[model samples]
Target chain A: MSGDHHGSSAISERVRHVEALLEARGLVDEGEIDRRIDEFLAGGSPANGARITARAWVDPGFRDRLLADANAAIREVGLSMAGGLQEQRLKVVANTEDEHNVVVCTLCSCYPIALLGPSPAWYKSEAYRSRVVRDPRGVLEEFGLELPAATRISVWDASAESRYLVVSRRPEGTDGMSEEELAGLVTRKGLIGTAAV
Target chain B: MPDRFAPGDAVRTSTADPTWHTRLPRYARGAVGRVVELAGHHPLADDRARGLPGTTQAVYHVRFAAADLFGDGDHAVTVELWEDYLEPADPSGGTP
Candidate 1:
């Protein structure tokens, strides 16, 4: 019954029509669609959320503000940080160079919606969600990040109440650097807890 | 998802009604452990129900070493889990 709507194909065709117009006007080129989706998969990196997460990590004051109210703090820097939202809030996490951070709903794919856009497909896959909690060390190893038995693995379950984001630690060589400089050191994987410094 | 289970609230799997969501691993199905902290509760997170905006209501945490889970290892990794997945253990009981 829900199929009653004319379907998204109509909308898609209209969008393609606009794309053709923009291309004809020299505003865009062919294959831009492929490039765009690739960008989206890359943690929406072009949006510069990683930079924001990293800045919050270096500055305790900002970090406090972000954790308290992730959406507002993120917006201050001009990012639309949404928590596991009906578009409600935002939450941030810090993943230091030495220490890594990864989020798993374990129950569902509850992620920091605001700072980061939609959750990744792999994030929502049973392979990741099931394995991480049961064997954190093993799963991380698959990502090519093997931590010593001593290094603790903290997996936060992103519930509906509060959204969570990984505040990746700044790179080792970045000291006394400006906010812009520090932001450059941030990476999408760093935000998800696979990489560090 | 309250005082019923803490971070290390010695518990085993509840085979009684395993139909809903569970945080215990396949290996720790019958294992018992203690809760260490009280991770707040949220809606149930199930994948079968996609586009499910909300449904997670579970308190999470580090489940301390359960004798049964890790055979001979003296030290066991802490397993975080939700509360509805656990129940109070009987001193003499192992699985219930």
Candidate 2:
């Protein structure tokens, strides 16, 4: 049900109408919208997030900086959330032995698109948006992620301008792994906190 | 406007459900939570959504216990909220 196409044509139709209106008013030139979309999409991917997470796993100082000030720290890795006119605020939360963090936007599909690429289809689904906030543990279980009963879960709802990223705990036995090797272990779900790295 | 609340302050979200657009989600309305961090000033999203010149307001990361929000849970939930959406929590007012 992730990419459920129900009512999508209606949305696309409405969007086309608005785009046509804008174009006719000279507000946007022909092909400008598609070009901008392509440009933005080209700049984003899960690799950017994985690279940042791998650096943090190996560097304590970098991890501290990233958790303290994500926007500035991401620049150190040559990644940015400044894809739009106003840069969305980024806050990186780390999972710990006793705590598990998950990110969700209950209102809409607000996400760190520049850092983690486009959101997964499930992320924007009504089931996720409604249930994650109410039953995060259940939702995680559905995602095949099960934490200890004692491990406290903190669900970060992106209801404002700030977007969140979860820095899952570095896996054990990976101390000898190189940064690139560690990065290879990261997935979009891990960054989104729906799975452990 | 000047920041009305700081990190660690207890606040309750306004329960008012405006017919127009608002960033204050219905699930959070009237709930009490403690401010975790001051996320700096951002334009009031509700006003911005209405095509008006929005005023900047302090946004905070507020933490709410999951048990309190959803009846029974051992976890917690955090939401970034604007200053206009919150008020100082009344110590005597029982949880919503």
User: Largest DockQ belongs to which candidate?
Assistant: 2
| Model 1 per-residue lDDT tens digits across residues A1-197 | 01211346976798789989888988877878668656544444423666676667567888888866666787767766432114544446565434456676655565554345566667777677766755667777887877766656666555334555677656666677888777677655566665553
Stretches of candidate 1 above 4 Å error?
Answer: A1-48, A65-91, A96-99, A106-108, A157-162, B1-15, B20-83, B86-96
iRMSD of all candidate structures: 5.5, 0.8
Q: What is the interface RMSD, in angstroms, for predicted model 2?
A: 0.8
Chain A TM-score of each model, in the order shown?
Answer: 0.64, 0.95
lDDT of 1 at A114: 38
Where is the poorest 10-residue window by lDDT in model 2 chain A? Answer: A1-10
Could you give me the TM-score of model 2 versus the true structure?
A: 0.95
Spell out the clash pairs found in candidate 2.
none
Quality of candidate 2 docking, DockQ: 0.87
**Model 2 DockQ class:** high
lDDT of 1 by residue, B1-96 (tens): 235655435676545535544444455556566665554555554432354675455555544442455454323444455565667775345545
Question: Lowest lDDT 10-mer window, candidate 2 chain B?
Answer: B87-96
